[model samples]
Target: MNNLKGPVRVVGTGLIGASIGLALGRLGVTVHLVDADAESALMAERIGAGSRDVAGEPQVVVVAVPPDHVGAVIAAQLAATTSAIVTDTGSVKSKPLVDAGALTDDLSRYVGSHPMAGSERSGPLAGRADLFDGATWAITPHEGNRPEAVELIRELAETCGARTVELSVQDHDLAVARVSHLPHLMSALAAGTLVDAPASHLELSGQGVRDVTRIAGGDPRLWTQIVAANAPALTTLLERIRGDLDRMLIALGKDDGSGDITNLLMNGVTGAVRVPGKHGAPHTDDATVLVNIPDRPGQLAKLFADAAASGANVEDLRIDHSPGLAIGQVELAVKPASVDQLVKVLTERGWVVHR
Candidate 1:
């Protein structure tokens, strides 16, 4: 399971597919890249991800196309070869299996998987060899799926530096609706709020607003298909969010009885704390140390070097630039045990440290 053997055919040349190829190829696995767009396949090949030519029988076939196209493409791949095990990286799972009915009835060799990693970018150009490092890659296999085939799929995920998890197709879909699809819809909705705003208001916006709406910049065409394909699950989640918004609105209309607003805000505080922190573990409230950094090329690097010199591991970092000043505030999150030492180290290194 450590190294993938034999030829692996990838039926898409986008970020996930190309990244899989790059990870496998680097480990000396033979990878064959394919895409409906010939140029995309060629581009992935040119990037040393894999070759366009697939000669012999493949040991594995990865279908990494759009959500709606997954079932059809997986069916086609199954029709093309009965020897290889097939898997897909689509977000939705149950719908595709239902769509692929007969093709998946003998689902011994087919599995559905999704890697919990990606930027709001696509195509071969955005592929990274380490895209899946330490990321959870969920695998959903039918009750009758062959164990060996599932093992091979897990091996493929591990080869790409991803942790493997097994989940039912239904559970997988529901989990993603809460954690992924709902977030995307919310981000898009938040970003849409700015569509008609005055230019001056947008100009004054800072990183916090940008962070909330970052995923809104994804390809609309792709996202539309994704949202539509998973509409049932997404709609349910959206309705719950709508209910919360309704409560907040009603609270705003109340006179002298707006305790509901505080309750709603407290609910958000509770929910936000439930989110997993660094390395997918329970959240820990780390100490924040803010330092004023000069607007210079190597200032950030120097700050990190100083922190390392003090042996204080920086758990997380964020930066905010002054509107009209030649400086930025670098916020560093460190363990409580290391905060005092880090502040002392930075102060000695001529950094204006703020706790």
Candidate 2:
């Protein structure tokens, strides 16, 4: 926090930039907002993100523009601002560095950072103050980067309620390609299957399809730039998936039920279970207790209160609404030992409990 001692200037007022402004503004820091789109900057300011006025030289300048524009903007800002650490929140790191290198040889004051937090929504209107809470922010400091500048960005991340992780420029690009870019592409590919699907077939779709294609709703233009920027890593991963898909197809064509498809499916289960659970920790074999909740005000609050009274702490939960139905199904995840007690208590309290 001490590293972020002075005023900050955010060069873009999009979701990430506005959210950062909102978070830092709450911390009693003087934040100045700017954007190529004046409307965006004004909207962010109206939302209490920050002020549009620039009083003096800011301590740090945050570049929150699109991935393609990050390098030039950061380069220009680095040259324009005196003694200010320039950092960008671009999802891809390596390409921006390459672009910035072409523009200016000096990068001693520039650090690349990416916050692993966002939604499918965009613009200042979709900005949330707590978007970065409990999120991991990657700080990629290259050779010749100033240690003091790196520390300033690290402290800035902490001030915004995010944990910091260090990664090299190449490593950051590779890691994000695997986890972030690949998933978006996969989701878009899956969702693309439904583009021309028969209306009858699409009507039969369930939560499975929705869950699988959720990230596909993101802005395609932005994603296209991201995918192209990290094409080398993404191509390798996509080839692996294609190989697996080809194997499954070959297995399906055989009359004899070989274990190829079975093994492939089982591998999916193993990988899915390895996905981190709440708070980015290792997954737990938590028991789920489902309760049918009526669509009524205060019903959810009451249910939670009852769960608290039952002395069972729910670790995690999700609510699924049945289309055209007036009720929702609440799945409360708890420690395996508390499942029985939770079910018993909810059932006794007139909740339609399901295992």
Candidate 3:
């Protein structure tokens, strides 16, 4: 695709918008960050996300607001940037598309997009330049959508290192309801159960519990808006999962290992294993080491340098930190065979190895 000359306007400086700005900026594309809150727009720009103000008409406009506000925001943005092609990163597309269509006659330049990538964080500060790397971005084009507009959005996703998957609006909602929305609801419910339990109960939690409830920490206001917007599809998917869960409970009550409940659980495990990795290949089970590093300048660089010097290819990394902590735990995922070598390397470099 040929590089467009005009600036790209991102109309919300949340995590998704800021990330898009960062990716576009890195591609030498001028980006204008526009948010209702001037502070948020300024913050995004300060973090190298984009320019602070909306310049003349942008070539492309991305609306990245909360679900509840996305439709109104997109309409406003479309009106403001009369000549620009518009798209959105809202989780639910049909509602916003319908709203935009009903509210305006200039629907030709609008396409709906949802990038299947995020962390349990919000706002510009939580934005990462590599957030969209190797993720799938869903493009939902309606009858009124211009081919050029859709292609431009696809190009944007490609530039940010995301694979483009075209889906009908209905299909996109259904798929995300099953894979994304349902899981968020489940995580929230699972975490809610522990609210009344004693604090000591948390100490006994294992990785399984942690993994299941991890997304529960996401912004509740944001999720509330999303779930409400996509309630129909999300509720439908949740009912299916609830039915399966009921069957499992009944099977356990009957003490019957021969029931179909085992198959249901096995299907979930198999489905999870089918999710592709960064290189678009199935992920393999691997071991990981947790290294505790002091929260000081250049500590992470030192650890990574030491790991490379010792000939360890870190497969993945997760950092756990808290406010004002002197140290943070870094979980380094690696090949099972390489764990020993990695530990040896870190220990030799005078770093604390937590296993």
Candidate 4:
């Protein structure tokens, strides 16, 4: 039966776990939330994630503990429940499979799934039912799993509002290393350099620096377990990055290097555009409209209204303002064809518009 008939038992009450509970609750499915920290489970229940009553046998057991604890938790849940289709939300899949496999042999009821959605923030209060909306969820079903068990997990993911991609365990680990784990490590490395910078240098920071280092603010203790679990894949990618750095340094040391730095920058441009746009399709053909607004209430609402008046659908947006500044810049991303009319309308309406 490829159904997410609950009560679904969620073994952790952190952001991802609590968000899953909240999402399932929207479907009127019963969710039983548990955590090593009792207070965490209570907080998750308080935030409408789920109940902490631990009632009824679970139809599905979702192991959402930290990466280091996921395998053991999965094994324990399998033993505790007789017929539940067990799954996990761990970012790294292979390690948990190995760990759980070592602790037990009856893995026919288990599948590994990772919902590629989370925030740099953690804890139950950070949970939101829509966290997985329009997000990608990877499903890695080992050979030991029953066919219907895999389908049930797929249903579980879709019920939580995510698109699913099935890949082998090795492939999933490698893919996440390049797209997720490596990027976090890179962000951490970049952010680490600014730790001891002068106050004057820090004052010049803008959206560029914030964009580069945003994920660096993630919980280091948690990320350490993830990074370590996926170390084999990450090491390969990091070595390639090291090679790129060495070449860049050599090119920079030379005078007037022909096309070396240019080629490096071009490589970046080539890669950046290939990243999928917000709609999850492989397209990035959107232009930005910048409008200056007063840093006051209702300005954003008024700006959006003005943009809508021009018949342009704002695909994405960001607001930027330095500390102590009374004005802000709003970057509105709209389709290219809509940009001209949007800009003209905003400019005619007394907004200081820029491309």
Each model's lDDT comes to: 0.88, 0.90, 0.85, 0.92
Backbone clash pairs for candidate 1 read: none
Model 3 lDDT tens row, 212-264: 99889888888888888888898788788789888887777785655577788
For candidate 2, give the lDDT.
0.90
All candidates: CA RMSD (Å): 1.8, 2.1, 4.9, 2.1
How well is each residue in 1-355 modelled by candidate 2, as lDDT tens digits? 4768668999999999999999998788888999999999999999988999978889999999988899999999988887899999998998888899899988898999999999878999888889999899999999989788899999999899999999999899999987789989999999998999999888777678889999899888999889988988898999999999999999999986479989999999988888888777655777888899999999999999988878888889988878777989999998889888888888899999999
Scored by lDDT, the top model is: 4
- Tens-digit per-residue lDDT, 211-293, candidate 1: 99998888888878878778888888899999999988888988954789999899989888889888775556788899999
Name the candidate that leads on TM-score.
Answer: 1
TM-score for each prediction?
A: 0.94, 0.92, 0.78, 0.92
Q: Which has the better lDDT: candidate 3, or candidate 4?
A: 4
Clashes counted in candidate 2 amount to 0
Clashes of each: 0, 0, 0, 0
Comparison by lDDT, 1 against 3, better one: 1
**lDDT, model 1, position 211:** 90
